[model samples]
Target chain A: MNTPLLTVHELHKYFPLQGGFFTSSKEKCLAVQDVSLSLHKGETLGIVGESGCGKTTLARMIAHIEKPTAGEIRYNGQDIFKFDKKQLKAYRRKAQFIFQDPYASLNPRLTAGTIIAEPFIIHRRNLAQDIDTDLENIMKMVGLSKDQERRYPHEFSGGQRQRIGIARAIALRPEIIIADEPVSALDVSVQAQILNLMKDLQDEFNLTYIFISHDMGVIRFISDRIAVMYRGRIVEMASNQQLFENPQHPYTRILLSAVPRL
Target chain B: MKASPVLAVDNLSTWFDTEQGALKAVDEVSFQLDAGDTLGIVGESGCGKTVLSLSIMRLVPTPPGRYVSGQIALNGLDLLSLSEREMRKVRGKAISMIFQEPMTSLNPVFRIGDQISETIRLHQGCNRSESHHKSIEMLRLVGIELPEKRIKDYPHQLSGGMRQRVMIAMALACHPQLMLADEPTTALDVTIQAQILALINDLKRAMGTSVILITHDLGVIAENAQQVAIMYAGKFVEYSDVKDLFSLPLHPYTKGLLHSIPRIEGDYCRDKRLPIIPGVVPELSRLPEGCRFHDRCPDVLPICRNVEPALIGQGFPKRYVRCWKYQ
Candidate 1:
């Protein structure tokens, strides 16, 4: 498809299982195994699964937040793992992450403006003067008032805090945004608002998204194509239409049917 | 031709005395639930669905929470007039509750078996050994595999779904006449949530237990509840049969909630934005003067902002709605 924007090849992540005193051996928990997917330039690819199903692990590997035990992540035809120090730092600027819990992901001590300006302070060292303007634009883009920047995370509601999180994600104008269950913690009414905001921002910036969530409704609402993960493996991958209308895999059918619809 | 209701709540108001003012968490809400019927109370967070259930159970903390005025009757007996000691007997024996987060609700220090057995023994007055046996049976009934081994496992040893099943087992140990499930599946996965919902429905059918299922998901309510109540800002905005409610939702807030949810099966609108209620829920202490939802109501009238509308029934089978549009 015209040389995909990003390609993940055979990603595998394993954590060592802590054995009891009597059993002294190397045991591993395979969090994500042989998971591979390609993301187009301006389309959203949703990875959906239940808790502990390795969706989060796969997202972390794709975002380069966590190093895969065995795999290759190619961004713009170059392996991300093989990047030198300078190249890796540049790659970090190209991709940003929005965490699941708005309450825990943000710093409680810092004001919203300071938090949004952090990416610029860390990455664009010479853009200190433009940080304030950049932060204000990003906040407005995410539907937050300019005055809200002075308030702490605790002062804002869950939906507003999530908006602040989104503002921070887009502050650096990253090419790819990996949002992991970004609206799952908010109320239903507010969830719709956040999802709508995300769609608008995606179009305005022409951004690619790797949206991860367990909610079929949310995934269906936001994604162009979806990859279903089960037990650390992608059981089915298809467009949103095909996956919802004619699910091929039994597990996929079960997952689709399990979603409570209005 | 109407059977006696298993539960009838009249003029129930639960308020909390916060630092600012008296916060009416649950306003004067009234509903009658027949035995074996599932009544779903659906609302967003801070809408007082949880507080309504808590008020029914008399579990609202005393210092901050106070029952303004209400009558909660279970099987024609008023629970509000009962003493603390007497209410304790009615808690686990006649009525039991399942909370939202199973992780925190289950005592981590105790084994799964001990917690279930404790409920059984306390309510049924059974001996230790008998309670243990019943606990195992309850666990098996909830479809937990390897109940014999799982009985010895602590709450931490189980997954989220398994922990919820243990909570169910504890709640159903005595076969209580009424079960109050407050967002019981909110914390679990979709597959596990489906299983839990099915199990609850099956058990309710088998035991003839009426359920007051509290959740924010209208979809869940449609599948499980026969009667549905839509709450907004601590008041029952609409109450009707599930089929009728879904087919003909009267209140603007109810319609807003129904339309706000994205459907999985229907025609996909790829680019269309979801319709959302604009304003946030008002704080309990400073609720809007008239209709709690008038600020966000699309069909709002001048009267709606000045005077509160009473919940009035429309016709047969009692379809109740509190809105100026209806008046």
Candidate 2:
């Protein structure tokens, strides 16, 4: 409808393969190749793929965590790669990435409160006075108790740790959140809670999500549109209903069939 | 029904002596598997599904873990009473186990062929050459391509799916009567999982091997297992035929779990919020006195908090449930 919130054009990321010291020839692994997608505001775009399908790599490249070897990523109207340092900093503030493993992502030594406030400390330097209040609000918003703020990541259970991760992701109030397998590590019952929390936060903050998971049930539940990736390429992309009901690609069909359905 | 069960676990209780207290990880759990039947143990993490399997395999670490009580009878032989040295003979020959993570389960240092061949040699008492040939055959049996070449490849060189296939091949190398697959496909992709599952089913049918498939996924249990045990907080809260379990789940926890999962095939209402069981699973040391799940149960009763309900059978084709409402 309107100009897409984010536009990716023929994105590619090639990882160069290292050989023995004597070997002179150079080779590369094409992780993501010729990928193009547009994300509308407030709608979740789910990227579904098996491990090593480059879904994570794609997410990282879009988040600017990894530089694309070729092609362009446009945030709003401007090319993200072309942005200057100030604009890049602003872009970083607007787009945040939630990693797969909450245990590994959060620094074990840092207090939950300090981790949540780190983003604001970096992006909004003038907001130092309100950091504590901001951290408290974010923690409360993500269903964490106020008393748990001083605890380290290891103190919390998997679910609570994930809530802490979510708290950190939304601390800066980013418009776009790229969550990669956010609930995969959680138990089934806890997964529902986190999924619901994410949905609620999206409504509350008017957030657009780029949700990535290999679990079909989760992707089906959360996404408006779904893209099925296979071997560094998107084989199918459609509305959730269309994709699930009429998965056109052979790989998508196989994936759908493989999902252990209840 | 007259034939003796291949494996019968009676009142099996596994307790972990933690710093806090004695944690009853698997309490009074009982089940029987026929020669070729598949029994699926479905439960969330920390629900003792893993511990139950580990206990059966005699793989639970001691000092912390202790078999407080119960009998594990495999082919009428009491496994619990057996000496550690004797149990070692039974581990791979009678009952083999496939772990959740194939990557960790496999040794990275050894070639796939060497690992499989080692298992064959250990259990079958075959020579190196015979074991090597059998290893290749095992690889072929599990549907791995280019067995000769792939055999030489290390665990790191294989894909997650292929590694799992290798694990299966190694597990089945000795042709064990019983196979304990503890979330064997959990670490694999859906497509790959399906392939592995199909492979297991095929092997089970061909070899007449009994299987204990452990997973949190109801879908996997539905497709693979003939019987299903719904475990919660270290107890088999419900057990029944898979068809009946799906059609009429008696326990509140089982119902909650079945409803909680988002269905891909059936009529799925996308807008409605998933019905959630409130509260987390109780910590093992400080579990509630009566019902471990009463805190999270939707149909909680006054008696549920005070009196622990025994897992009693419902008169019919054979169904068991542990709940006040069932009583």
Candidate 3:
């Protein structure tokens, strides 16, 4: 647990609800309010919240896809917010994000192989020929056949498309992978397959995942630790088993009660 | 046996004639739902869950998709025989639908009030103001805050959960006898998913609305459905009471599905690794000849690969399964 990979302290993200160009001010909707958690090396910390609970916003900030309004995001003891331009460029390789919708994330025109190899082309110079071998390895790791790499996103089913998304995310071999609702779009039966694949890949790669999801069952399955968010704040953060067995926060209890009994 | 059920679908088969080949989407599926009864259809994507709902409504577009063979009897009236004009009358007035994507299901350009009121005015022959009042009441019934002001907002303005609630309100606007909810909460978050399920159940009990809840989540089905039908490769592999299906699943596929869910309750994961059902659902165009699930099934006897298993024995009183596990 001492091997902390990333630490977020008093993170805040506020979006203006209403505004005019010059005349009027706006009401601020605190999207993420004072949320703090630490991600250990090779560990998955699952974040669970309702639709507007700012989980995705928090994820975007952590992945540096969006700048935090206020907070100190420490990556390997260095404040990521205060990173120099060169250091920030280096940070992009260490933390990558896997978006929720596979179809949305991927370009329809590009082949799966091209999509996976794009990151390599962006970061590593003179890696053109190596793309094929790297792509094949990524595709195999995510349970896709070699033949599947040539196909477009539309050709594959929802589950298969998600697999390609996973391949693209892990292709860069980032230390931290932030998967945002990766399996929510999938079917219940297909969900198990994707989750299992992720678990396997996590162990094999020794990767850290900030798994974001709405399904309590899924969070329980993949996460070592769980954080329950409410309107904007994390009400409870503990081990998965502890939170599932003895949920303390009122919102957490409400969420637990709402999970459909199987 | 003397009294036929309220809704009887016998040997229902729907197919799509794509450029590739004739893909049988829903094949030889049969079931009956009495008045005020809920039948949950569970299946993986591309297993014809949506097609089943659309086929029953006779809404599958004609060019690519076709309901080739089926007898859909609603209260002893054969629905498949009805004309499109007649089906339109029966659609909102008799059988309503709450589609999966709420934002798309409701017209975006129109106001929420207009969409709901338009449905009421068209179906129930109410005036504009009257329909508006009724729509607002429906919105309040679904627990939307400030129904009057909220109903004026467009679908895009509202959050995902709010949009879903508006969709529910619109679907119930006409007070149909039976409602077909196809992955209704698939787009919403878990907490919101629970609220929507509870709302549907409350409305069903209050209005005695018989429902065919089609979803892929067993947890949602187990929570809401009294009866469940397990679909695989466009066929019903198992059907029974919810309790019975959970307690003693008759089919291997059903058992695998039930066990595969990463449950929060009970001792599910004995080992550290989650219990996973390996292999993906087969492509519809390249389906196997015999038992559809034979390839992925854990307990595969020799008979599984060669011949298809018929729905044999009333497995759990009203239960049925198309697996040799029961035989």
Candidate 3 per-residue C-alpha lDDT over A1-262 given as tens digits, one digit per residue, 9 for 90 to 100? 3858899999999887667877565688999999999999988999999888899999999988887789878999999988888998889988988888877988999998788888898888796768888888888888898888788989988888999888888888889999999988876677888988888888888999999998888888888899999899999999987898888998899999988887
Model 2, span B185-275: residue lDDT tens: 9888888899999999999999999999999889999999999999998999999999999999999999888888766755434355677
Tens-digit lDDT track for model 2 on A1-262?
7889999999999987886688854798889999999999999999999999999999999899899999999999899989999999989989998888888999988998888889988887786669978887888999998889899999888999899889988887888999999999988888888888998899899899999999999898889899999989998999998998888999998888877756
Determine which window of 10 residues in candidate 3 chain B has minimal summed lDDT. B266-275
Fnat values, one per model, are: 0.64, 0.62, 0.68
Candidate 3 lands at a TM-score of: 0.93
What would the TM-score be for candidate 1 when compared with the true structure?
Answer: 0.97
In candidate 2, how many Å is residue A110 off?
Answer: 0.8
Model 2 stretches with alpha carbons more than 4 Å out: A19-25, A126-129, B266-270
Candidate 1 or 2, higher DockQ?
1
Tens-digit per-residue lDDT, A1-262, candidate 1: 4999899999999987997778965989999999888988889998998888899988888788899999899999999988999999888888889999999999999999999888888986786668877887888888887888899999988999999999888887889999999989988899999999999989988999999999998888999999999989999999998999999999999988898766
DockQ per candidate, 2 decimals: 0.71, 0.64, 0.56
- In candidate 3, stretches whose alpha carbon ends up further than 4 angstroms from where it belongs are A1-3, A22-24, A127-132, B1-4, B126-133, B144-153, B156-158, B266-271
